[model samples]
Target: MTDVRILGTGAYVPERVVSNDEVAAAAGVDDAWITAKTGIRERRWAAGDQATSDLAAAAGRAALRSAGLTAEDLSVIVVATSTPDRPQPPTAAYVQQRLGATGAAAFDVNAVCSGTVFALSAAEGVLGRTGGHALVIGADVYSRILNRADRRTVILFGDGAGAVVLGASGGQGPRVRHVALHSFGDLSGLIEVPAGGSRMPVDETVLDEGLQYFTMDGRGVRDFVGDHLPRLVKGFLHDCGVTPDDIAHFVPHQANGVMLDSVFAGLDLPRATMHRTLTHYGNTGAASLPITLDSAARAGAFTPGDLILMAGFGGGMAAGFALVEW
Candidate 1:
């Protein structure tokens, strides 16, 4: 049986770091209050001219370099992002072109913060069927659509990109074991950008209403995390024929520190068992999970034969989980 091993991983964050103080200055909030609430001290934001595709391309190039392969060797590209260069180009094609990749099918995916895991599952399935190598990237420039005047949303987002190269390998290499994805569109209103999609195209009214900005029912998000994450993790582990004890580490979407802490407390798991990156990255939306995983891997956090549980929950009321061996 062919296995899809992560050959290499890479991430790119813009050089500019936006500190809590800077955010507070812009938003009329205090640094202490923000830190105590979200555990975010700083985050990276792209230069004004940079777009999501630029970040994705940079990460993709690094991933290919780390794998000792060129873009030509890639058989597919899947870019997970809510913010694309244009509403139509899919963004993946631009990354593919930037990398000089040819003949590799490419497209975009949207599941908000859960986009990476959902895209990863899709890549694994594609590899399972075709036995081909795939490049999965999560990149977002959330600042573009943010309501700068609204500190609640602007302060919570940043820009970055992370990529992983998944290649078909012999049975000895690590592979995806079990994956699950679910969404409750009924609760989609919990978080959204009201004006961008077909439901409400950008117009004078949208501009007047600030509809393109990120909006969320913070209480709804809090409630969902407090009630849903623990159950999802457990259900995923059960379906994968594993126990919480069997998991070497839990890598979840780095939405907020408070949410993650709550999940740990609810699961009765030691805080040390969960890998986190929200403190430095804030929330990169779809890029959060993959970026955390990449950072952890680079820090030598995993060992051979270790089971890792990955989960994410976000807009679209989306949630997903997967179990894999490192």
Candidate 2:
């Protein structure tokens, strides 16, 4: 089997930086309250005209550059995002057009925050079978869907994008060892955007009720993670024929600062092994994992012959894990 190798990585954040104090004042909370809950001091918001595709294309270009490849080299483009430029066309199509990736098969994947993991798994298989390169991007503009007055969802999300180029391994760089992805749709109601889909389309009534905005049962999500995340990690590592002691690095989703701490406290892995950026970036949905991964990689965190464990969980009640050898 031709294992998928990550050739290069890139991440992009919008220029407009938003501080916790700014959001706290709007949400009728204190800065300390927001920080203590999410461990996020600040996050970035996209510009008025900026959209998810713009962010994805920017990160895609950078990843291609890092890989020493051009847009023409990409055989496919997979974008994972819940906030698309428009509902009619898949977001990846806009990204493909922006990148001028003429021949690439482009599409969108919406597993919410677990989108990157889902898209990566698909990209890996596609690249492996096709014997060509694929660009996998996780981008989200949660700012667009957030109800600014709803502190629960508003303070917890930011906008960003990250990208990676996947191709056949030539006996160098990091190679994907095992990828485990699972979804439990029964718990999907815990997190959702209530309207604007097939079951509930947009209308004056929906807008007045604010059904189009993001909504999350924060405590329910916390309880769900506490119940499932540790077991998922343990089961994935066991299936991959490894243990916590064997992992050189762990890059889980940058969900929230305090939430991550709570989640990690129960896990068997060492604390320092986890890479986190939630303090500064908050929860960037699908972009969280890749952004954290790229930042750590660019910072020279991964070394040769190191086993890296990556995990992500999100809105489909979806979860994914990948074991990589660097």
Candidate 3:
């Protein structure tokens, strides 16, 4: 069997930074309180003109460049995003065209915050079977789906894109050694964007009720993480026959400081082993994990044989953890 390796990684966040005070000014809160609670100072917001596909394309080009390849080298383009450019026609097709990708199969995956991992699984499956390279991008302009006046959800999300090019390899490759994926649909309502879908529309009622914006049950989400994440992490590691000490790094989804802290404590993970991006970009939803991986790789944070744990939890009340051997 061929080993699948992540050849390159890259990311892009919009230029606009929304500060905590700015968000507070739009809602019922203060900067000090927001900062103390979430450890977030500011987050990037895409311009009104920017769309998720644009960011994904930019990140894709960079990832291809990093891999020392061109768009023509890939056999597939998989985009993992919740904030797509449209509700129809997968964003991957748009991304494929923008990259001038010829004859590549393109599609989208919606696993919310765990999107990149889901997309990665698809890419790995392709590589494992057909022996070809694949481009995977996770991008979201969550600001487009937020109620500017709702601090609870608005302050916790941002816009960004991350990409990775994976290819078939020999025995010496970046292997996804183990994984655990679980979802509890009953708690789905705890975190979701309630309107603007086929179930709801841009009607006067929705507009008046603020239904177009993302609405979340923050306290419910917190409780879920506090109760579930540790057990999940422990189960994943134990199933993989690995110990906490064996991990060189822990990269969780960049949701917020509170969720991250809870997961960290529950897992009894050493603070030093955790990698964080929430401080810089808040939560980019599906884009968070891959962006962090890209950033850390560029910073020389991983050695050739290091073990890295990639995990994420979000809107499906879904969660997944994967162990990667670098």
Cα displacement (Å) at residue 55, model 2: 0.4
| CA displacement after TM-score superposition, residue 243 of candidate 2 (Å) | 1.1
Give the C-alpha miss distance for residue 187 in model 3, angstroms.
0.9
The sequence of per-residue lDDT tens digits that candidate 3 reaches over residues 1-326 is: 35777788889998998888888877788888787878888889998888999999999998998888899999999999998899989999999999999878999999899888888888888878778789999999998888878878877888999999988865554667866778889999997878878888789998888788778888998888888888888889899998888888898999888767767777875633788888879899999998898889899998888899999888888888878899
lDDT of 2 by residue, 107-191 (tens): 9999998899899889887877787899999999999998889999889999999999988755566888889999989999999
lDDT of 1 by residue, 1-326 (tens): 34778888888988889898888876888789789988899999999889999999998888888777889888889999989899888999999899888968899999999998888888887887777688999999987887776777777888999988888764554567777999988899999988888989999988988888889888898898787887877787787887777888888888889878888778754423789887888899988877888898889998898887788889999998867788
RMSD vs true structure, all candidates: 1.5, 1.1, 1.6
Model 3: residues with Cα > 4 Å off, grouped in runs? 171-173, 270-272
Model 2: lowest-lDDT 10 consecutive positions: 263-272
Which whole-number lDDT from 0 to 100 does residue 298 have in model 3?
91
Q: List pairs with backbone clashes in candidate 3.
A: none
Those runs of model 2 whose alpha carbons end farther than 4 Å from true positions after fitting are: none
Tell me each candidate's TM-score.
Answer: 0.96, 0.98, 0.95
**lDDT winner:** 2
Indicate the worst ten consecutive residues by lDDT in candidate 3: 170-179
TM-score of decoy 2: 0.98
